[model samples]
Target: MDLELEGKNAIVTGGSKGIGKAIAKELAKEGVNIVIAARNKDLLDATAKELSKETNQRIIPVICDTGNSEAVTKMVNIAIENLNSIDILVNCAARPLVKVLNHFHLKHRMTIFGMI
Candidate 1:
């Protein structure tokens, strides 16, 4: 089905694997150029190359640790530079905080939980 997405651009966080990668693939199939962000440069590059070949759409990769605000900002800037403008954003990046919470004090954990 045509999504009327030809020439559009998108940024998909955590797009090197799993759900985010699937979304990026679908968007690329719909004719959308994409900037896929993830922390692993090698994985991101591989995924980008594979998707670009499969969908015949531009797929750029940006290395970004989504838990870091500065990294996220840089990723956005890179995406914009590569794609010209962002028409879609898929925020699929996530951190498994369970292990981290185990190291924290109960009060800190409570604070973090509240934030979550």
Candidate 2:
């Protein structure tokens, strides 16, 4: 189970709960420092504190909304500054266009995914 991930830094988007939380926990178990980002301050703070207590790992909670370009940029910048580098990126964000992502008044649901 040695991922050779000791001292490595990781970024987990939508990491406040569910799948993202599970991923963060696994990474923490591997001795990886985690930067968890979400839009909710309460969720982010609570998750950070809980994870830190469970793993004794450095947990940094970043309040970021992935749908905003500016916020995404800020998250990346701050993560680079804080974690040194993003060795692992766990992108669990769900960008849906079902309600507001329509251009030209088109109706569609978009789940965007890509590497940063």
Candidate 3:
């Protein structure tokens, strides 16, 4: 399957690992230039380096938290500047935690990880 993505540009958030990482590797294989974003600078940098070596593709890892709108804006600007135009934008990120409110004490305000 040819995505016709040779020399394309994209941004993959939470790309330091997990699904984001898989997408990046796949895109790189398809010849899509990618900019990976995550909150962890160290992990991002290392992942970028490794991906670059593995697929021999152009991958730039950035420390930008998607939770912050400002960071996302800056990331967009940088992507535009570097890649000129974004042909693809893959925002595959996840929040690692979830809480359920089964019994919330009005005064204490307590919660549980999983509740019915």
Q: Which one is best on TM-score?
A: 1
Candidate 1 stretches greater than 4 Å from native? 103-105, 108-116
Clashes by residue pair, model 1: none
Question: Which is the leading candidate under lDDT?
Answer: 1
Once model 3 is optimally superposed onto the true structure by TM-score, how far is the C-alpha of residue 60 displaced, in angstroms? 0.9
lDDT against true structure, model 3? 0.85
C-alpha TM-score for every candidate: 0.86, 0.83, 0.81
- Candidate structures ordered by TM-score, highest first: 1, 2, 3
Work out how many backbone clashes candidate 2 has.
0
lDDT of 1 by residue, 50-106 (tens): 999999999999999988999989988998888889999999998889866775777
Q: Model 2 over residues 1-116: C-alpha lDDT tens digits?
A: 89899899999999989899999998998999999999889999999999989999998999998989999899989889998899999999776666564552442223243222
Candidate 3 lDDT tens digits, 36-113:
999889999999999999988889887897878998999989888888888888888765543222323432443433
RMSD after CA superposition, every candidate: 4.5, 7.5, 5.2
Please give the lDDT score at residue 97 for candidate 2.
Answer: 63
RMSD of 3: 5.2
